[model samples]
Target chain A: MNLLVDAFAWIFDPAHQAGANGIPTRLVQHLGISLLVLLVASAIAIPVGYLIGHTGKGRTLAVSLTGGFRSLPTLGLLIILALWLGVGLEAPLIALIVLAVPPILAGAYSGFEAVDRRTIDAARAVGMTEWQIVSKVEVPLGLPLLIGGLRSGTLQIIATATLADYVGAGGLGHFIFVGQKSNDYPQMLAGSLLVIALALLSEGIFALLQKLVVPRGVVANQSTDVRRPSSRRVAVVGFPTEERK
Target chain B: MNWVIENLPLIGQRTLEHLALSIPPIVLSFVLSVPIGWLANRYRWSRGVLLTVLGLLYAIPSLPLFVVLPIILGTGLRDSVNVIVALTLYGIALMVRTTADALGSVSSDVTQSATAMGFSPWTRFWRVDLPLAGPVLLAGIRVVAVSTVSLVTVGAVLGIKSLGLLFTDGLQRNIVAEVATGMVATIALALVIDFALVLAGRMLMPWTRTVSPKRERRALPVDEAVTA
Candidate 1:
């Protein structure tokens, strides 16, 4: 109990506000590194995902490999990259980009795949080129899922970025590492709370983003089907029509 | 290469340790999640709070959690247990949301018809809802299992002997072979775990297999309508 209070007090203390080093300045530095990692990851992944989804060829293999990459432990990856790249923020950043890629790719592929086939066909029937169908139709329709993947990926990168402290790339993780070494419970808790707050804030922001971007038509379709009178009348006479559809 | 032959025994021991740490969490989380999911669904407002907490939990970085646990729980297995507890918390959050979403996806008519047929709420849930929701729930579980297998390595960072220690030590010592061995072992474990879950998903949810036939037939018209 005292530990919790002490930790809170330490965090709020003006003298300790940024650590012996400027705290806000250090946090922004960490955040900048994290965002840079995420941006690079997104740039690599979104294009690859878009290509795979648009082409719809070898998507299974591409997605499977990406999933496999995602499952590789980030700590292990960080260690390996640190060894190969010789530490600093760059190694961890590279490792995180690899970690982030899979989800973004999978989300993009699946989202595009889920785009109503009719919509794609409708576009094609009107003589829309393949590029046009993708950029205008499939991409727009798939934007929500892609964004969801980005949201998840961003959160993941931020959470995992703390591990970078082990390699001398400073962030909130510095507090955690230093606290662990010194047995400073308050400092450790302060860092943990900051991470928790960051995570929740990001999730809320993304959920709101999803609300803003996801097509209204898709939402209406999902809810309206739920509310249909016939939905309540299940005869068990047959499987759900929508399932078949 | 010589390191491989010399450390063969260590590699085997590490594999066993990795499996020990990873398997228990996956199984424990699965067993706990089903009931917790049901409870969350039963309570409305609390469900929202529970999920919010879980989402936050899921976002927690593993290393911080590792360090924080010792402060609260002393050290050693107690610390590891904290990791498990944290993982389980995240697992329940994911499972509950997925389970609820799958259950919600079940058509209302199916529920109404089951109710009309004199099936009790318990019976409807067990015989109907559980079976239909099995695949979706399994998908979530599969994800959790793979992730937990990877996470067990992080558990090793806090002096829990497992594959992570091998990798961490190898990197520190610049023992390339040990690092390779650990990476290979971890990846192999992930693949095996994932394969086992996929097989289990298929066996437990036979409906998943049968549903495809009808879906294929419906695809033809949907395809045609779109093309036209």
Candidate 2:
């Protein structure tokens, strides 16, 4: 009880503040690392996903590998990366990227694969280039599921970012790690609260993004908003807008 | 190569250890989730609350949960119980939604006919509702099983002596082989578990096999009609 109280106090301690007000420095550092990780991972994974999803062959292998990647332990990966990269932020960044890639790749592949065959065929019949068909037809149709994958991946990255601190990469996890080491309960709780807050906030933001990007018409038939909690009326018109006939 | 030859027995032991940790949680979660899902389905209001709580539980990270549990419950497997509890919460979140969705998917006419024929509510649920919902529910369980298998590796970080322990220990000791072995074992175990569940789902819900036939017939007409 005393430990918990003290930990809270440390979180609000004005002198130790890392940012504006009493916001901890470690949290900012961790969030930055996590963002960097996500950006890098998405850069690599999205293209790979697009390729594998679009290509008819080797998809099973690609998907299986992605699943394998997802199951790898973040902490263990970080430890190995830390050894290879020599600690600090880089090791955790590598680990987070590896962790984040699989979901994004899977999401992209599944989303692209799910694009209605008729829609793609119609797009091609209308003289749209293959690239244009993918960009204009397949991607739009697959947007919701793709965004869902991204949302899940982002939340996962934020949660696992805490482990970065264990490898001396320094994030909000630092507070928790420090608290655990020193038995400072309040600091640990404060760090944890911040991590959860960040995760929830990201989830909300991504959910909103998914709603905005997904074709309004497609979402209307679904009862559950798999992406966001907000009930917005998005218009989803049935495919083949009639002119193709 | 040399390491493989030298530590073959130890690698085998670690593999077994990993399976032991991963398997029990999945089985326990599945066993518990089914009953909870059934109960939740029976009570509409409680179902919503249960689902909300379980969804929130899914957001909690394993590491912090482990750390907090030891503080609250004291050391060892008592602390490890947090992982089980959290995993079970996740199981309910996923399984309940799937169960509810599956049950809802059962045609109303089927239920109405059953009721009209004087079948008791209990009989309707068991003989009709459950059978129809079986494939979808099993699909959900398959997902949960795979997730739980992966999650159980996290238990090793808290000193549960699973594959995760091997990785953690290897990292701490700077023994790359141990970490590699542990990771390989974890992946292999996860795939095996997932395959086993897929097989089980197939065996238990035979209707899923025929779904492709139904889908294909619909697809043919739609494609020809639309193309024409």
Candidate 3:
């Protein structure tokens, strides 16, 4: 009980709230790294995923890549990159980018996959151009699932960024590692609390975004969001619960 | 490579420890999830609350959970039990949803037939619903197995013994071979376990094998359990 009290006290201690190593700075560092990684990952992954989902050409590539990457442990990869790159942000940044790609890619392609095939054909039948079908129809309808991919990717990055400190990158994980070394249990607990709060905050924001992007008429269909909760989102990448309708 | 040869015993011991920590959560969570999954699927209102809460739980990272569990459980910081409990919670969060979805995947006509045939709900679940839900349930369990095996490695960050020890130990010593060995060993364990689960699923649910592919496609996207 006292341990809990002390940890809360440590977090609220105004001393811990300001300065280079303070909670706010650590929080920003964590969110900043995660956001950067997600943006870059989305830029790379969304294009490729969109291409695959649009063309239906490289699904085999997406599946194998995500499966292989999913099994690769974050700690092992971070250590290998750190060992190879010799610290600084490069190691963790590269590792996080590699890990973040799969979910976003899965989301992009699966969002397209979730769209009814007839809907695409109908867009074509109505005399729309190929690009028009993609941009005006597919993109609008797929937005929710794409955002879902981002949500899970954001959640995964935030969680894994906490491990970034192990490779000498900045994040709230610094406190946990430092506390672990010095046997400062309260500090460790506080760090854990901060990371959890960040993860939940992102989850909430993404859930709302997913709901908002549902493309008003499409929301009534119940096709896209059917198993959204059941898909192995959040921690693991891909393995989205299969579309049932 | 030579480093791996020299550390074979250490690697083997760590692999065993990893399995020891992993198996309980996978099994226990599956046992706990089925009923909870049934309850959620049985009642409309419970599904939203159950899935949302569990989803939030899953969103929390494994590392933080490791550090915080000891505080809650009053165990030593290094206790393997903390990893077990944390992983079990994660497993439950994952499997409960899968279980509910798997049960949901069972066709209503079949269930209605069983009820019409004079079998009670209990008998229907055992003889019809569960068995019919078997393929999807197996898919969910296989995922749980692979991920559980992989996640046990994270426990090493807190100084808990598992295959993850090699990463931390190797990093500290700057032995790339040792770290590489840890990665290989962890993936190999996950693959082997995944394969075993598939084989077990085949043997236990032989009817799934003979089900026609056209019907199979219409019924469920079982392969998505691996590929999404």
Q: Write one digit per residue (lDDT tens) for candidate 2, span B27-122.
A: 776667666766666566767777766766666676666655555555443355667666666676778777766776677668767988999999
Q: Higher-lDDT candidate among 1 and 2?
A: 1
Tens-place lDDT digits, model 2, residues A1-245: 55556656776787767553345567677678878878888899888888877775679887778766656666667777887777677778778888888888888889889877887888889999989987878788878878878877887788788877777877777777777677666666677777777877887787689878788876775664221122333335566464222
What DockQ does candidate 1 score? Answer: 0.37
lDDT of candidate 3 over A63-165, digit per residue (tens)? 8887777678889989988999998899999998998999899999988888899999999999999999889988888888888888878887998899999
Query: Which candidate gets the maximum TM-score versus the true structure?
Result: 3
TM-score, prediction 2: 0.79
Sorted on TM-score, best first, the list reads 3, 1, 2
Clashing pairs in model 1, backbone N/Cα/C closer than 3 A: A18-A23, A231-B108, A231-B109, A234-B109
- A165 in model 1: Cα distance from truth in Å? 1.4
Worst 10 residues of 1 chain B by lDDT: B70-79
Off by over 4 Å in 1: A18-20, A214-245, B39-50, B69-78, B106-119, B199-228
* Candidate 1 TM-score, C-alpha based: 0.84
* Model 2, docking class: acceptable
- Listed in order, the DockQ scores are 0.37, 0.26, 0.37
Please, what are the lDDT tens digits per residue for candidate 1 over residues B30-102?
A: 7777766666665667577767777767776766666566556665433557767666666666787777667
Candidates sorted by lDDT, descending order? Answer: 3, 1, 2
